[model samples]
Target: MPVQATSVRAPFDMPGILVPDFRHSRRFQITEFGARPGDKQSTSIAIARAIRAANAAGSGSVIVPAGIWLSGKIHLESNVNLHLARGAILRFSDDPQDYLPPVQTSWEGIECFNYSPLIYAFDCENVAITGPGRIEPVLDRWKIWSARPKLHMDALVALYDMAYRNVPVADRQMAIGQNNLRPHLIQFNRCRNVLVEDISIRGSPFWTLHPLLCRDVTIRRVSIQAHGHNNDGVDPEMSQNVLIEDCVFDQGDDAVSVKSGRDMDAWRLATPCRNVVVRNCRVLNGHQLMAVGSELSGGIENIWVDDCHFVGDGRGGDDHAVPINNLLYVKTNERRGGYVRNVHMSRVTATTLAGSVLAVETDVLYQWRTLLPTYVRRLTAIERLRVSDVHVQQAQSVAVIKGERDLPIQDVRLSRVRVERVSGTPTIVENARDVTLPAAVGRNGASALGADFKNSRRI
Candidate 1:
């Protein structure tokens, strides 16, 4: 039977999120199904068999014992928990053929049929991946696949065109050719009451962990270290009532990126990503601590970030750290018609920042500008952003807001934010309204703002 774990309370005032608890569940060992260490094919087959056994027996855990086991794609079933014992290392196959037969997955923000994620769950309930083992991809093949040549760009163009025309999703397949749209490390698509806890994940082909269109997710005490291109630590896309806490993220991109769908597909779905809380997390290196959309056309609301910090020296050491950039970034373009509201951040600290503390840009389409013409001119409405009790030792700038003339960003407030030193201008504003940076929040506890800026021009 599927379990609906009770909602867990959050420190904030929002609704509690549900998480699966599988304490007394029956355990099905993979070794019993003839799994052998270091054999990818056998281990993969054994894992599938064990999952079937566990699911058929009501609810149970499919246990992977301590060893170096190699496997292919793992498709989670309903009412099943895939647990790994201590000292267990599950390495995934590097060959592309292991992920054949395209699955319903998304790339960036566009939905299409692509290679299955290394671990995937579609339309399942009460699923969890727990325990203190390591799950990683072999980077040998993925490192080369990361580069997007003309073939990949052409595939992206086709995907965008399909979305624009409202083509059936079943017909849009990109896994047939050398498109090279890499799959995510783990994806739980349309699954409810999901829990991912105590696992260490390293080396991703794309975005590391994604919870898409799911409800009531709890990700706790996990560690991620993936420096590959587009390797965001966690992306909660079009999901609701999520709580991510007590995690350590050393990422190539943002630590937590909250996104909705993109453009036309988003408009059709009209499901906003809302009610997400990220707390008590640490970032070693990333583009930003948190980023909200260049893909937010379905709208986003009610996000809270609390007690997060950036650690590690900016100098790239033997660990190949990339250094932290901005504390928070909200990016969008004219082609996306969405709204971002009620975003709050508090108790954040950083040793050094390569960019501004907060940045909002209205024009942030990387390659889409020239690749495709804007079929529709739609703007994103961003408002009601608050930051408080943030202290940074050094930064390039305090804040930067660049909004379009027609639809400017509004109602941004900063309080008790102290930066010891800045290399560039303390604040830069363009086409924004009601930006209140109080005199109390500044460099060395001095006034950085002379007065409240309303409908300000570029400075």
Candidate 2:
């Protein structure tokens, strides 16, 4: 049974965040454009025709009714809504040649001309992808691209150099011959007033749902179960006024990772991911329920996660039992110069957490340590992080907050947090200031009043 979440309140007024409505819109059917069900023929041209007809009709829906439609890529236009009826399945082709003529897309926060995402929209307004249907990408070819050979690493290094040297985005073309850079499943780039609701997504080539530099986005009642490499469920990068609610994430990486581009590219963009809210969500399995960076260089602020459930021990039989790495994780390194502040999480319930309930580390350089040379070392400023009313059934540690000696984390508070079983240290604090844990509990059925602190003061 799924755990029921309590009522959640948004931290700030979400004025412009509302679901887009298409009640009286006209419908352009894909079948009318010669699309057949279950045929091995590519439906790319047919779907594209249908979208063009819808767009030409002035704000309408391109309907895909109850069938398995195989396609290569889908490019959405302005004032158009792609709607799938119940039992509709849109399967994408796995061949790399299908998504040709690289469009304006990004590879891990660095802007480049790469292969288009499976469903892509660029600089459009009032666009949506809504349905009670499934969008699956056949990854037989993409899975091979997952291997990061020296060629891939060299390409990455080139991108980093170009970013630091302030190269024009048009000059950074990554889709050369035999260069395997995976594309996102769905990406809305520089779009406004986007809505994705009631959709089921599976088998992504890369990050599942990515909204880059978008504004006023709402993703509600969606289900994503993609476990491919680098398949983060939802990545809102450099986006603003976003809301993700009542979604289920069974991912291979962080469920909801809020990023603002990466180092030099991010500094160049100068757009912080701000005013995002995630509520009433369920994490069946993921690396973390919510993660705030390893790539945040443009800063992240005013994030709220409330009334969520993270079932780390899986939701099915024995094969499904994978413990979550952490419940709430904030990770940044010295090379990432950003500010993380005003983050609040409340009424979260979890079970079988492999790490601490809350873990914040500053020097978490996963592959960048050996991958690229640090161009500028700017320490992040993390402050005013608060977690409240959280209950964890089991965890390795209650909390671990590690900050840099030169730049300490400040004003962190954990209140009304309880853990049933803790097998490791209850709390570990270092290089912080004004840290307070009023109701932090552990396996001993007592408050964490005796935990040791290192280089921290004003508890």
Q: Where does candidate 1 stray beyond 4 Å?
A: 1-13, 315-319, 440-447, 450-454, 457-459
Separate clash counts for every candidate: 0, 0
Question: For candidate 2, what is the TM-score?
Answer: 0.95
Candidate 1 lDDT over 182-295, as tens digits, reads 988999999989999999998898999999999989899999988888989999999998989999988888899999999998898888999999999998878889999988
Task: Estimate TM-scores for all models.
Answer: 0.96, 0.95
Considering every candidate listed, which one attains the maximal TM-score?
Answer: 1
Model 2 Cα displacement at 133 (Å)?
Answer: 0.8
**Superposition error at 158 for model 1 (Å):** 1.0
Worst 10 residues of 1 by lDDT: 450-459
| Backbone clashes (count) for model 2 | 0
lDDT of 2 at 147: 89
Q: Give the range of the ten consecutive residues with the poorest summed lDDT in model 2.
A: 1-10
- The residue pairs found clashing in candidate 2 are none
